[model samples]
Target: MQTTRLPHDGPEISVLALGAASLGSVYSEVSQANADATVQTALGLGVSLIDVAPYYGLTKAETALGLALQGVERSRYTLATKVGRYGDKAWDFSRDATLRSLGESLGRLKCGHVDVLQCHDIEHGDLKQLVDEALPALRELKAQGVIRYVGITGYDLAVLEKIAVEQQVDTVMAYCSFTMQDQRLGPVAQRLKSHDIAVFNASPLGMGLLTRKGPPDWHPGHETVHKAAAEAARICAEAGSDISRLAVQWALQKAAEQGIASTVIGSSSAVNMSDNVAALNVPIDAELLARVEAVLAPVRDLGWDVLPGNGGKAGS
Candidate 1:
């Protein structure tokens, strides 16, 4: 596995990081044993950065991770979890709430403190309060040695750019923007680098929109987008390749070209975990990738609807 040091003095983490939402069972129920196995598999593969949130499975992810890492030394991996929204619609960034959330996350992860503490889903919260109250609180926690890095996660590229320039964050996570269908994240890489803030792109598969199985029911992509994705898959299949495998490789290569520190991916099954880890070693076939990209051109940059104030939908 390859590793990179986050720009702006952030910790060194694996280029292919583990996302823990599956352990939280966002799309399907994952047993505790499966969740434990998943984490162990990731660690065994040399994945050092693990991202989770209190919102995922409403704390199940953190608890499962805590149990999985029970006897493991903390120094072996870098832990990251977010605080802000507690549920699908619940939004809270109050100082007291942030403090309490951190304490609870610490307890749930069975750790003294986290390596990275981000303001979760900032686009869904009051921007004023987030900039005014929440971020300062995170900085305080960093000062107290509770967290080593501070950052924010959101789906809106514009909003993330705003935060990167105007606020004091060490890193930023942009999802669904760095996939094979959309390369929007490349435009903002230099901007973030200018601020010395590390960049982490999540959902390289476009939240499953770039895979052969297609997006899940909860995915926000429209019918046209789904159709385009299916076509993209067919293009790959015709070339005797798997679209999901190509998608992961493309995203990883793009991240390296753009100087992204890591890409976060989630999976519950060990087979999927092994495949994702293995994808890094697969050479990119330019002709096949170009064909796949051509197939998805119709939906290129065609993102889902943004919920007015609740952060732009996927690919936004």
Candidate 2:
């Protein structure tokens, strides 16, 4: 596995992070034993960074991660978890709540402090509250040596840009993928690099649309998402690359080219994990890259105009 340096303390993290969302059973049901085995396999494969959230499975994910890491040396890996939301409800950024949240996360993760602590799903409203209330608490924790670094994660590029410029965060997690089509965060990513903030590209496979077998309609999710998946499949076929491999490779190569430090790929099965890890070694040529760009051109326009406020629909 390739490694990248975190801006805070220069700790080398795996370029491909293992997202623990699936372990929480957000996408599908998973047993505690299965989640533990998944984490063990990831560590065996040299993946050091594990991303989990309090909201995932209402803290089940963090608990499972804590259990998986039990008795393992703390220095062997980097742990990241998020605050700001709880149990799919409204956002909360109060200082007291933030502190309590961290305590709970620390207890659940069974760690004295996490390497990376992020503000989860930030948006337009209450931006000042985060800067004034939440971030200061995180900074205080960092000063106290409870957390090594603090950061933010979200789908809004504008909000991420604002936080990156003003907050002095050590890292930023943003959504990016070849199936994204619109390439919404390309410029935002460049700006983040300019600020020396480590970048983690989330949803690199567009939430399994790029990797799953068959076309988009196979999934019973949103129509727009399925449509985008279909278009991505066509593009991959044109490029003579498997859509899954193409999607994963595009994210990895694009992050490398754009100076991103890492890209997180969520996996539920060992076979899928192996395939995704393998994409890091696949050599993509210039011609195939161009073909992918061109094939996605038409679908990009369809997704560009629909913003998140429009029902929080997928593929936008």
Candidate 3:
């Protein structure tokens, strides 16, 4: 596995990271046994950065991840979990809430402190409070050695770009905007790299849009977006290939080219875990990738609003 270091005196991590959303059943219901197996599989494959959130499965993700990491050396993997956005629509970024959220996350994760503590879905919260109250609280936690680094995660590229370039956080993770079907994060991540802030691009499969089965039923993408993805999947299927493999490889290659630290994808099954790690070594066929990209051309950078009514990159 390839390795990279975070900016501003952070830990070195594997380029392919593990996302714990599936462990918490954010995408589907997963048994604790499967979650445990998945975590072990990720560690076995040298995936060092593990990203989870209190919002995923309403804090169940953190708990399950905590159980999975039990007895493992704390130094073996870099732990990251987010605060705020506790539910699908619940969001609070007050200083007290931020502090309380981390406290709860620490308890749920069964750790003294997390390596990376991020403000989750900042665009969904009051921007002013997030900048003033939530961030200051996170910095305080860092000062107290409760968290080694501070970061932010959001689906809004504009919001992430503004805060990542101007704020003091050590890293930023933007999802669903950096996949094979969406290349907007390429230039944005480049600009972020210039500022010495590490970048993490999550959901390289575009939150299921770039898969053979297509996006989930609840996906906020447009009908046209789903159709284009299905067409791209068909093109890959005809070539005896999986669209997800191509998506993961393309995103990983792009991350390396753009100097992004790691690409995070959630896996609940051990097979999926191993497959994702193996994807880094697989060669992406240029002709096949071009054909898939051509099929997805119409929906390039087309994203649905993660937080509807916020004027985000919806239908753009």
Candidate 4:
């Protein structure tokens, strides 16, 4: 695994970060021992950044992560978690709520201060509130050495871009995958790079649609998204690469090509994690990339039409 410098002069982190959402019971249930083993395995594989949030599994993810890092050197890893959301629940951006969230997250992770603290999924209306209220507190914490950097993450690239332009945060995390499926963040990536703000892309696999199992209509919004995913899979197959590998490689390659800092992939099992890591080694030829793009050309929005709260239920 390669390491990249954090934006705003913070610590360096692994290019491939391990997302802790799957370690919790939201997607599937894992024994505490298994979670610990997975965390340890990721560390051994040179993955230094672990992303978790208090809302994941109702704080179970953070608890599991804390237990996993109990005996390890805290400085060896760059820890990150979010405030402004709670447990598959709703989003809240109040100043007092932000403080309360951080306190609880720190207690759950058993850490005095986190390396990076993010404002999770803040919308346009809440942006000013965040800058006015949360920003001061976060800056205070950073000044006191409680946190090294501040970041903002969300599914909407527009919100990310707005924050990156108006705020001086250390990093910004967005969702960008291969196939130009959602080009929403393309410009945002360039903007962040110019500002020296590290960008972390999540959902490289588009929420498991690029895997061997193909897409599923898990929810109402997934109906059209699954169809688009299947089309992408077919196109990848015709081009000599599976959708799974292509999706991961597309993100890693694009991030490297564009000079973004890192991309995060969520994996529940060690086998799945290994498969994702193997994508870093897969060779994506010009022909394959071209064909993949052609196949995805017809669906420019790429099912973002069904995104939650956008008059659809994708994220819901």
Choose the strongest candidate by lDDT.
3
Q: How many residue pairs clash in each candidate?
A: 0, 0, 0, 1
Q: Write the per-residue lDDT of candidate 4 for residues 33-95, one digit (tens) a residue.
A: 878877887888788898988877778899999998898998889998988876344777777
TM-score of each: 0.94, 0.88, 0.95, 0.88
Q: 208-277 in candidate 2: lDDT tens per residue?
A: 6565464222232345655656666776776566777877787787777777787887766666777778
Candidate 3 collision pairs: none
Error of 3 at 203 (Å): 0.6
In TM-score terms, candidate 1 sits at 0.94
Write down the lDDT that model 4 would get: 0.73
Instruction: Candidate 4: list runs displaced more than 4 Å.
Output: 87-89, 176-180, 215-222, 234-241, 285-289, 303-316
lDDT scores of the candidates, listed in order = 0.84, 0.75, 0.85, 0.73
30 Cα displacement, candidate 3 (Å): 0.5
Model 3 alpha-carbon drift over 4 Å, by segment = 305-316
> For residues 123-208, what per-residue lDDT tens digits would candidate 1 score against the true structure?
87888888888899999988988788888998778998898679958889988888988778887976787778888899888888
List the pairs of residues colliding in candidate 4.
55-87
